[model samples]
Target: MAKVLVIAGDFVEDYELMVPFQALQAMGHEVLAVCPDKSAGDKIKTAIHDFEGDQTYSEKPGHAFTLNASFADVSESQFDALVIPGGRAPEYLRLNPAVIDMVCAFAASAKPIAAICHGAQLLAAAKIIEGKKVSAYPACAPEVKLAGGDYADIAVDDAITDGNLVTAPAWPAHPAWLKQFNELLNK
Candidate 1:
């Protein structure tokens, strides 16, 4: 089974993280719920809601789960893919030296990475999107371009595996995102 790491921190789009997590679990993959040492709570919240909603759903950490490891300690060699959920989490995660370095390693190795919503912020920080085709929330177009990725209005599940990288828009694009991700891991 593919071992996927889902990076969650403060403002992680609740569903952006949960949907793919549940989907990957249903497929029998080992999904690791990870949070930077600094993300709010154990499970983290959504920019809209703490639980992956635009309203106010928050998943308190230690309720039933927690991040597998700290960003500083996680090793890319152990993961098949890296998933970064959108929301304000990326905003802060982008500034974390550990998160930035880990992300850079993922891209350098061409490991499959799936990002949604504001998660583009993390990529922009890592400078891993250059010359690659990607999609994200409209507000992040400039960041995408600045990071060197080509922005598009494509569906989330378009399966953009360009030499081991994957990108998505947001939660509403989960179905397509999950589908493409499943395919990537399945291979």
Candidate 2:
């Protein structure tokens, strides 16, 4: 079984974070959830982003998710794969140098990386997606392109995998995203 590391932060999309964390565990993988500056037993608030006939997704308060590991203790070599959930959190997480370095380490090693929606922000900040085809929330297309990655304008419920990276536009693509990621981990 793969030891998966999930990097998340406050306001991470509720479904994007919770679903994969739980589903992967259910699939017999050892999963560890962490947030920068937070330790095990700490909780991070989540936000639900739903497409409610508006120009963009609408946000609502979501459940408080507990951290199972401390970011300070995270070492890239300790895990086999990385998962980054999207939401407002990525906007701030991308500004942390340590977070950027961590993502780069995972990419450099060719570890399986699954990023959804705004999660592309972190990948772009890490500058690891160059020449790759990445899918993220439509609004993040510019950042993906600026980072030298080809933006995959996929459907919200679709996912795409390139090399060691598996990406999707949003939580709606969880099934496809997680499935592709799981396959990468097994490889």
Best by TM-score: 2
How many residue pairs in model 1 have overlapping backbones?
12
Tens-place lDDT per residue, model 1, 1-187, is: 8999888875566677777888898999998777766332355545443336555434433223345555555688889999988877788888888888888988888878898878888888899988888788767889998888898777644535555666777676777777777777878
Q: On a 0 to 100 scale, what is the lDDT of residue 176 in model 1?
A: 75
- Whole-model lDDT values for every prediction: 0.75, 0.97
Q: Can you list the residue pairs that collide in candidate 2?
A: none
For 39-123, candidate 2 gives per-residue lDDT tens digits of 9999999999999999999999999999999999998999999999999999999999999989999999999999999999999
lDDT of 2 at 120: 99
